[model samples]
Target: MAQFYRLRVHHRQTGEIHDLTVASDRYILHQAEHQGYELPFSCRNGACTSCAVRIRSGEVFQPEAVGLSQELRDRGYALLCVSYARSDLEVETQDEDEVYELQFGRYFGGGRVRFGLPLEDD
Candidate 1:
């Protein structure tokens, strides 16, 4: 028998809170959509931050969530598209750009860019 868990999602943009009952075997995002909640999401394959959320309470398992780094996951970040509830959960939606920056921001503005072709100093 499949176990179901209660999920509380707080939308950061609109301050809307959605309550849902999700099966442990299903992805949280998919289940939310199936229940008529319009949550933010892009890639449903766990390859993007569009469905990122921060675990506020309880736990989720997302071993296939490649969009998140171990550090981020340790910091309570999760990709709803690939996450399965391990227990009753409370998550807050994260801004995509914010999570993206946290994931790859270090690489930005760290290298020198040569606008034109490099001139050979003969």
Candidate 2:
């Protein structure tokens, strides 16, 4: 049986509020797109953080979201492109950079780093 759940997606970047019903058997982002909502997304296969969102309420299942870490998932983050509504859901789009930072910044961003090899003396 196909189950439907209410979904409330808030676009923090655009300040758009979309309220609609989504099906548990389909990806949330696709459903929203079918309903004419243009939410941020990139790499619809769930490999990028562009579709990242934070679940403010309710539940979702995203077993294919390889872009997110278990820590981020535990922190209520999900990739809408692969997430399925498990219950009435309330989510807000997250800044991609923020999500990226949370996922990998610890290993890279550590302040100014001199780029390129030292210029050869003339």
Candidate 3:
């Protein structure tokens, strides 16, 4: 039988709660996906820090880490895609609105152009 884990993610801005149940071996990103939560992430591996987040409570186990700084890990920051819950967890992170805005800035907004075409704007 597969073990079950409970997750409670708190959106820091709106104070919305996402309660989830996932297989013990499953990463938090999968749980977020199952719940239709648009979590910010890039590489599914621990290479990019885009999935970085702070744990408000409980603990997670990570067998491998390529991006997380030691200071962050000490302070409870984790890469959700490669971390497993060690207990019922409460995580705090920037809200969906901020993630959406970040996505827009990366894909469609002029933030990219401003950084790229300095001569055009100046």
Best candidate (score: lDDT): 2
| Tens digit per residue, CA lDDT, model 1, 1-122 | 66899999999988999999999998999999999999999989999999999999999999999989999999999999999999999999999999988998887657543568885554
Please give the clash total of every predicted structure, in order: 0, 0, 0
TM-score head-to-head 2 vs 3, winner? 2
Model 3, 36-92: lDDT tens digits are: 986767888977666767798988887675666575688777878898888888887
Off by over 4 Å in 2: 112-122
TM-scores of all predicted structures: 0.88, 0.90, 0.69
Q: List model 2 lDDT by residue over 1-122, tens digit each.
A: 77999999999999989999999999999999999999999899989999999999999999999989999999999999999999999999999999999999887788544577765555
Q: Residue 63 in candidate 3 has what lDDT?
A: 66
**What do the candidate models score in CA lDDT, each in turn?**
0.93, 0.94, 0.73
Backbone clashes in candidate 2 total 0
Quick one: ranking by TM-score, best first? Answer: 2, 1, 3
Lowest summed lDDT window (length 10), candidate 2: 112-121
Where model 3 places Cα greater than 4 Å from the true spot, the runs are 13-15, 94-122
Quality of model 2 by C-alpha lDDT: 0.94
Per TM-score, the best of the predicted structures is 2
Best-to-worst ranking by lDDT: 2, 1, 3
